[model samples]
Target: MRQWRLAAALIAMPALALAAPCELKIGAMGPMSGSGAQWGLSMQSAAELAAAEANKAGGIKINGETCKVSVVSYDSKYTADGAAAGANVLAGQDIHIIIGPVGSIENAAVKPVAARNQQLAWNAAYANNALEPRFPLMFQVSPPPAVWADLLIKRAMKTFPMKTVVIVVPNDQTGTDVAGVDAAAYKHNGVTATTEFFQRGTTNFAPIITRVLATHPDAVDTASSAPGDAGVIVKQLRLAGFTGPIGRVGGPGTAEILRVSGGLDVLRDFYWYEAVPTDDPKVRAIDDEYRALLGKDPMGGTTFWSYLPGARLTLKAVQAAGTDDAEKVAAVLRTMPVEDPNIGKGYWTGKKQFGIAQGLFFPFGIGIIKDGKNLGVERQEAQPE
Candidate 1:
């Protein structure tokens, strides 16, 4: 009887050892097919990179078992209908953690689906104040417009002493919301600001440029303008003889703007709200890895900094909570300090503004483009109003 039992145990040992590790699927939902395809693709790429790194390091540990991370992405086309469909698809795949639905309009559509599924969503785009109260599980990892706007205005005032500013943004809801926040920030900083909206897909910015320059403002604030629109506006503004400061308040689009502007050196002296400091060892390492994997530098936007760091923070929270449970991970995220290479050490904020501590409050990097290269010069911490 003893010999028989030993043989049976030895047979079962192989099966136990060969058991497959639990798979953790992370959903990346964004505009993977529209004009903002670069944004969505970058988000997907960053999340994949993070997952690949974790897998290399033996993946996430839970209950003494290893969980392999996988990022499953879906294209939302930057629309409400598309976002809803994408959310449903991700939910069907049993993905509990979603990276985006990039714009506010898309996120608005995704909120219900996320709430219904009880999924933890990290908003990779700008923080829409309206979404937080309704969707408790949705968290905004990017700094809110209020935070970045404050920094932009301060830097503009100190460097150029601007008094009157003209804000131009897309005619969509996201643009309207950002313009409001930027207007408030400018007002608080002792600057008068006016806003002009342009329809999405308006390639010719001459009319808008003429009208904006006619205002005789000290600076033109492109508050959260789409990458293509921003490039055209900058190019036209320079061509139209507007020499004052141009606030690229909508994160750095250095490469895109340069490409769109026909390499015209239009972004010189622009106050960009974010840029990866090339001098930082961590930033360089990430860039190197990204270039190696993607065969190109990260899109000239927040992708390099936002998604990768957000992924790192999410995994850290999962490790801390000891499970992939959304509530458990969220609880850990609320108290965790994010020390990623992109945003640096910071805590989750936004209780006063959004009635939830879901926004990542970190030092915003302000940089300038000189001779066609972005160089991070100053860092501003988010201050309470």
Candidate 2:
């Protein structure tokens, strides 16, 4: 009788396992390799980690059933074409709602595909104004870049009284947008800036640095995406004997600057637009998990900030909607609250802020680069800057 009872229990194990429902598929897209791979990879990893944790907690409860969440990640290669292709592929799948392809460029590419399929896309990167012109089935989770500049300028003015400022920007869409924001902020702060713009891959900075030095500016700012670009720009300025505070609103955090610039000492006195607060328990947990798994801090802020929130929030929306119906799932996501580790908790809406319904709306966090090696997070704010 004892043996028979044991056998019955063993036989029921398979049925119990099969009873667990797996209905929803969560998909993410980003560049997992090449020059822009860091952001995509980090977001993908963070999203997957969140999904796994959610599943361990008995998955998402919807309607009368509990469904397990599975994640699908695609590499957009940081190109619009790659983003579009990934979106096309995923649109053909059974995913309820999609998280991201990290880069603003990728987001722009994928937006149309998402709209066609009635899939809701959450823009996870910084304030990507270029994507503003296109209206799609998407919402933002952060404030715009204009708001980022507003916050930085406000803080800097309070911290240091400045008379003359210089604004340097990359000749890309991002740089142009940030440069405008900085200019307006400086004007509002009772300062006039000497503006200069450079092409994205320009190897020569001596002339531009020399020109800025001759003006004897009190502060300098750049709106470039690449950490190496910002680091090299600052180092070149230092080598040219310019002794002013440097701040890059769009640059990677201090760690990446330190790695590529040979050391952070040469570029110690700068402020960064940090997306996540270092003190947040969630942020710390992510850092710990990322370090444990990858053996390094996630390289780019854009990657982690965009990917994790996109993944987590999208999952929440799917769970809320209770089914894999893309339209309904996306609709639920539009109304869900975003409790992002990076930006704190906020709702994503693009229509009111960006003047377009397809852009992402999210919060921005600020940080300071003290000494030569640390990124001290300042604070998280709901305002755009």
Candidate 3:
């Protein structure tokens, strides 16, 4: 009798395994406890929201079985070592889809681990060139600095036409790249630009403001400044008696900039690359939902819009490929057109630029702030052809 029972138990093991529900784990890794904490937190929140919505709709189908989705987040503290540690932790848990490591340095640290593990790294930040060839599994979800700079400068020239402008950038890799792109864009548009670099943790912009004003520039471009730093620099520029137009050549952070500058009144003649259209009904709905979930307004930057499409694209690719395999999903993504609620419609492109078709090219909105109101203007595919 004992031998017979043992044989029956061994035969039922496969059946029991088949009865278990598959857990599809997605990882969100970025700086959650440093100067860039807000950006990381926003990315994680957006990923969770997407997962929750998918699970509510009976989850995603994989291998002819329904699998429940889960988002696991790790704080990388915006450091190289921290990002590597976080990547290792997620890779150990068999997480194949990762949302972000916002900066270039952090992304560089996590790239090897993602490649070794054959994981998909969906980068919502880090627009430095030559990323796709280095890591086939990595996808750039956000528009690069060159794209935004070109649009902003072109619009500014057509609308305001400043002959000479001053550019302020943070002293970092992203800043350097943004500065170079902005300078080139300005030159191409028949405008001259003088650049100034400030330390990352700079609190006082008086000296920089003084030097910038001394240049007698017709406009000030803070295309590479972080959200907080942009606010400080703009406020100081206003107080220092320079009353020209201000252009932010980076992603939108208007709400935070307004708050940091005390009010919208200080931001006259301001323009920026908006993450979403101000009048898009879909954006309003998502923003309202996000506000309810977080007890505050959504992030004023691309953080609020970048991750949703990535998550949606991942889910769609998994459903289409009928498996959760990273390579298969990535292959599907290369040929898929991504149309999310807030991010609008876009397709993956970059064959000539990055040596791979891994970057999302979408129509981005350019917002003009006048008298505390943000007005949206659309730009169709500002990227190079």
Q: What tens-digit string does per-residue lDDT give for candidate 2 at 260-372?
A: 55676776667767555545666657766656644666544544654467667666766777766766666776566556655565554555556664444455556665555
Cα lDDT over the full model 2: 0.65
Which regions of candidate 1 are displaced past 4 Å? 1-21, 62-64, 127-131, 275-279, 291-302, 341-343, 369-375, 382-385
Worst 10 residues of 2 by lDDT: 127-136
TM-score of each: 0.85, 0.78, 0.86
Root-mean-square deviation (CA) per prediction:
3.6, 5.5, 3.5
Give the top-scoring candidate (TM-score): 3
Better of 2 and 3 by lDDT: 3
Cα lDDT tens digits for candidate 3, 1-385: 9999999999998999888678888888877764466667767876777777678778888888888888899998777788888888988998888887777667777788888888888765534662668688888766666656776778766667689998898777767777877888889888998899998778899999999999999999888576777888889999989888898886666666777776767987788876555456666587676665446665424456656677778777888888878899888877776577665777666676667778776666777766555556564443434
TM-score computed on alpha carbons, candidate 1: 0.85
Tell me the RMSD of model 3 versus the true structure: 3.5
Question: Local distance difference test, per candidate?
Answer: 0.74, 0.65, 0.75
Per-residue lDDT tens digits of candidate 1, residues 5-94? 999999999999998869889888787764466567767877777777788778887766789899898988877798888888988988
